[model samples]
Target: METAQNQQQAVCGKEALDLLNCVAQSPYDQEKCVALLQSLRQCVLNKKVKKFSLAEPHKEQADSSMIWSKTETWKWSTKLSH
Candidate 1:
């Protein structure tokens, strides 16, 4: 069970990383990252991933202002409008 969970996390993590890299490389033109973003969204839905941590939290950082901060936990909204 743990192995399966790890594999799912890996898949979603890879997709997310790819999207992040795409956005970083093309900050001015975000259109290029659209496909990558969609891919990550699809992976999240397919894997049924509710929440995932990008990095470990630091003791000093108590602010939750940054959306992509190391302490923030990303959650995927399952409700999609059709």
Candidate 2:
């Protein structure tokens, strides 16, 4: 499912700022909204491009370089032939 943030163009970072403002004034969900805004801010500071811009697709060059391994492969003797 696409989040409201992921569905938009990230126009001038306005959506993020708007979320923060809304959270400040919110009654029932103020904590949740504030937490999300803080998390967004932290992601950007961490240089986490994936979290920074969810709408953008992954770059093939970067994706191709990453190595992934499932935990079962290392713990168990079983290995798929194909």
Candidate 3:
């Protein structure tokens, strides 16, 4: 049982890593990379590593919102100072 579990983990890791490499190689292929990332996320969930949450529908949206908010705050601060 332990060996089987280890093998499954190894396979999942390999698949995720391969997808990452694909994204790295084709940086301009945004759609493909996003699909790969979603697949990787699904793989992790299948391994019971995380729980599904509606708060984070897409990986990019979650990260971009934080970044956008920070940029907006900085802009406001700069304007206030000027």
Best candidate (score: TM-score):
1
lDDT of each: 0.54, 0.40, 0.43
Estimated TM-score for each candidate = 0.51, 0.28, 0.42
Per-residue lDDT over 1-82 for candidate 2, one digit per residue giving the tens place of the 0 to 100 score: 9785344323224435556456656375877777767765664455433332222223332212211123321111111122
Query: For model 3, what is the error of residue 65's alpha carbon versus the real structure, in angstroms, after optimal superposition?
Result: 34
In candidate 1, stretches whose alpha carbon ends up further than 4 angstroms from where it belongs are: 1-9, 57-82
> What order do you get sorting by lDDT, best first?
1, 3, 2
What would you estimate as the lDDT of candidate 2? Answer: 0.40
The prediction achieving the highest lDDT against the true structure is 1
Name the better of 1 and 2 by lDDT: 1
Worst 10 residues of 3 by lDDT: 73-82
Which residue pairs in candidate 3 have backbone atoms (N, alpha carbon, C) closer than 3 angstroms, thus clashing?
none
Query: With candidate 2 superimposed using the best TM-score fit, by how many Å does residue 1's alpha carbon deviate from the native?
Result: 17
